[model samples]
Target: MSDATSRKVKRFSESDRNSEFDAATQKALEEIDVCQNEIDSINEKSSEEILKIEQKYNRLRKPFYEKRNNLISNIPNFWITAIMNHPDLSALLDETEEDCLHHLTKLEVEEFDDIKSGYWIKFYFEENPYFENSVITKEYHLDSATPTSESTQIIWKEGCSLAQNVEANKPGKKRRHEPAKTFFSWFNDNVDPYTDDIAEIIKDDLWLNPLQYYLVPDVEGDGENGVDAEEVSSSEDDEEREGGEEESRNQRK
Candidate 1:
């Protein structure tokens, strides 16, 4: 068993009561422990089986993901537009990085052979005024209890660093209003990798289903079917409520 699955078990204390009742309580507790161990064993086995299934499907889905990327490449600014459409991702971005992201030619998520080990998120950019690097990548290593990540350091073209520009714009003294975090600033933030909110959003949400975000109606004008931005948001909210209800129903089942 993995160390993650074989940690020390929580021991139960006997109840303080008459000797006979205490003994009975202790015996019942022991029985409960045995049942719990059995449950854990099943859970461990289930996780192994699920990982195998995920690995198998990962290989199967590789070509489709590649094809999607190729198709997306043909659409001008598809990725940048999609990124701007996503609620969480859009929040991270500001006017400072908007032009920089326009040069983003491709974005890719590559899972390791052992999917549980970790994955890499790669951003490919055309030669632009902002940075020299053609490709910037963030790698997550998930071998231990706490996951750690490393990102490619961007070599900015002289005087064109968007992150630095944002910092420089901030007032020397504390202001009542703080400047919004630029998306590029995320590269330098030393956040916990395992629970990094942006990483989680990208991997589990955006990477899996970018089309949903991409299709979101632009608030600036009427979108497809004449739906407005507010309508799109409302639709999403309704879907979320329905999804939650369905999950609750499944749990009850």
Candidate 2:
């Protein structure tokens, strides 16, 4: 038994020395003087490093994987309905060709660097009305769903005001009552006929639903007071600039 143990120790020590020698040889190969040769060696080293990193972290990042999957799965179905009913934004989705729809549907939020940073929805369709360019790519932070007080207040006020106005008018009174619809429904009903076709398409597509929450411009005051478009534009610009700065910082990192 003592002799067997000695043999096992000898084998392990031999294996360890072989590993150290191989590592030293690889390091020497990487230090080659030729630029092209060095580049090739570096590429090989990088690939091996990447494989090691992936093997180590792939299981660790599984939570982010499940979170993104849950996010996509739990997205409300009504969102699609709302998008279809959006006046200004529905047209952008409508002009998208069938090929664009297929691509959009196949997009999955992927994890990068253990951060859910590269998860983006990209729409590549001609004549996109929502943005300056025909292609729209938007990255959403994982924590973007956390509501701010201002956003919560705006949502509550809009929904409550609309509901209150609808309930206030007595049905018995012979009021020239146009059907009281929500701001979004009214906008959809009133938009140009040209957009109606696209709006219908938006209603049918599932991918567009995820964007519905951002479809309508936030309205302030009742129809009597009206909203200031200039103020809204200025606020939007500020948000865009802040977002741009954040993106720049992220790129540097």
- Residue 212, candidate 2: C-alpha displacement in angstroms: 14
* Model 1 lDDT per residue over 7-110, tens place: 42223432334344566677676566667777888998999999999999999999999999999889888888888999878888878688899999998899
How does residue 221 of candidate 2 score in lDDT?
A: 38
TM-score of 2: 0.25
Candidate 1 residue pairs that clash: none
State candidate 1's TM-score: 0.73
- Which of the numbered candidates is closest to the native, going by highest lDDT? 1
TM-score of each: 0.73, 0.25
Model 2 Cα lDDT, one tens digit per residue, 1-253: 2454445445545565556557656444334323445476679899878867875686666576556546644443333334444554444343332222332212233334434222333333333222233444433334344311110111222222222242233323343335423322322232122223322343344333445443544464334336476766787899999999999999999
Where does candidate 2 have its weakest 10-residue lDDT segment? 147-156
- Work out candidate 1's RMSD over C-alphas: 13.9
